[model samples]
Target: MKKKTKIIISVVAFVVAAIVTTGYIIISGMQKNLDNLKSIESNDVDLSKISDGTYSGSYKVLPISVEVSVTVKDHKITAIDLLKHDNGKGKAAETIINDVIKADSLKVDAVTGATYSSKVILLAIEDALSIATETNNK
Candidate 1:
């Protein structure tokens, strides 16, 4: 083969290998993140044990993350503010906060189309309330 043809072929092969490697890494990370999210189980927190105050928490599962501020008053979840949410096609999952406030619990159903996002949000809320529970226990 001509020297120029060999060089061109080598470059093309290198580019293909780079692309394939990058794709594999991304897919692998995504699969691992999904598995982590699936394994997340929101803990049952006792609201009555939580004091009246606002607490902050966050949960991240690559490509999806949530930060929440939960307000408790008279042992009830008065409100939930989503400080930050990084999601793909899960914007609708924000409404899950309302369901949580209404139920005053973390056992609410995940949003239909945004189940992953919903779970992350719930976990963040749980994280925040868990702090309160811990504080009260001390």
Candidate 2:
């Protein structure tokens, strides 16, 4: 009976340790993604110069990623097309282009159920806009 009790305790401890380690890894990964999102916000590419031609932008967020191409003419956005999107149940994020077209800016709100994907899509669009603005500047 003594030996059996010791074995059970050890097994429980091992299982608890495994669970804790897994949780830690998951939390750390989540933090890193959050940090990346913060970095995107800081890039601060001016949208005013986004004129003419088509530009592409992409951003990866672990299980999901976004690739968007935007067309602009005379400083107005003509179209927004999804070159690639690894969205998971985030069909709402697909409307990023339409929202930007309606607002004429990236300050629009994210879709309720697909907030993360929406932000990522917006970030990709921001990246495309950055490139477009840079090219126009040159």
Candidate 3:
């Protein structure tokens, strides 16, 4: 009976260890992706160079990601739509879109306590605008 109990305990320990190791690996990878996103530099959009149109962009950073569509009209950012935002405890960041539209720039401050989500959202906007510029130049 003691032998059987010990075998069961050993198997349970092994299973637990495997699960823990896998979880740790996934978490670490996610952290790396987050750090990379945090390190990204955002630049202001040059609306003057971009033709009036809607531009779509997306940025992903593990637990957080954002997709945005920006509308430009007469050399101004007229509207912004957040098509998708996958955030963890960063719902407040969604409000940043309004700030962007009001300010007509990505220079607006990030949402407090949701800094990562804020940056991702801004980056997505920048990406969309940048693509517009690229497309125009081509």
Candidate 4:
């Protein structure tokens, strides 16, 4: 084979390998995130045990992540503010926060077409409330 031809072939092979490796890593990460979502279980917070204040928490699943502050007042969940939300095609999931506040629980149903985002958001909320309860108990 000619030297130039050999160099071209090597370059093409390297490019193909790099692309394949990147694709594999991305796919694996996404699968891991999906698995994490599937395993998610929102913990219930005892509002009565939590002090009246704002608490913050976060949850991340590769491409999706959420950070939220939960407000407690009079032993009730008064509001939830999303500090940060990174989602892909899951912008609609933001509305689920209102539902959660209205329901006063994290057991609310996920938004359509944004289940993973919804789960992460709920998990973050659960963590925030859990922290509040823990701090008040301490």
Candidate 5:
């Protein structure tokens, strides 16, 4: 082929390859994230031994971070409040609170579209639970 034709074809090929490679990387990264989430096992927490106080917990999912306050009363979780969440326009994930209170644990399914945020929030709650468990043991 001519020099000009060869150069043009090469440029087009490079663009296509770049696009495909970027797509693959994005997909693989997302799958890996989901795998990480799935690997996070739930702990069997006994809240009946905790005191009446608020415990704070936090978890970060890269671009997002969530902080929460867990209030225990008479060894039961009486309330849970989100103190802060650096969500990138994904406010709907806050609904996880209802599930938390209902389950009285952080082992509930994450929201459909907000799975990452949900997992992070639950993990934060788990942090609080861990503290409660540790304190109860002491």
Candidate 6:
């Protein structure tokens, strides 16, 4: 009976260790992904080059992801729609879109506390605009 009890304890300990290790790895990966966002700079897309149409773009970084639809008219941004925003405590970053539209460029500042999400949002906008720029260049 004592041997059986010891085996059970050993198994539980091993299981706990495995769980802890997995959690640590996951947390480390997430931190690395977030850190990578610090160096990501959004390109200033020339709206004049983009045709009059709606473009869709998406960007993901671990805990934060964004999908945006940007509508341009007469070489100007008319509207921006955030179709999907998956974030943890980064909802304030949504206002960053307004800054982009107001500035007519992606070089606007990020939200105060939601910097990671702000960068991700800007990157997604850049991705969408790039499609238009590429199409026009071709």
- TM-scores of the candidates in the order shown: 0.91, 0.70, 0.92, 0.92, 0.70, 0.96
Candidate 2 lDDT tens digits, 45-64: 55566667889988888656
Evaluated against the true structure, the overall lDDT of model 2 is 0.80
Q: How accurate locally is residue 103 in candidate 3, as Cα lDDT from 0 to 100?
A: 88
For candidate 3, the lDDT comes to 0.92
Backbone clashes in model 1, listed as residue pairs:
none
CA RMSD of all predictions: 1.7, 4.0, 1.4, 1.5, 4.1, 0.9
Q: By TM-score, how accurate is candidate 3?
A: 0.92
Q: For residues 1-138, could you state the per-residue lDDT of candidate 5 as single tens digits?
A: 699999999999999999999999987886676678767765647777677789988887556688999998876677889998887555777898888888777778778778778878888888888887787789
Query: Which candidate has the top score in TM-score?
Result: 6
Judged by whole-model lDDT over C-alpha atoms, candidate 5 comes out at 0.81
lDDT of each: 0.92, 0.80, 0.92, 0.90, 0.81, 0.92
User: Candidates 4 and 5: which is better by lDDT?
Assistant: 4
Against the true structure, candidate 2 reaches a TM-score of 0.70
Model 4 spans > 4 angstroms off: none
The CA lDDT at 120 in model 4 is 91
lDDT of 3 by residue, 46-101 (tens): 88899999999998888998999999999789999999999988899999999998
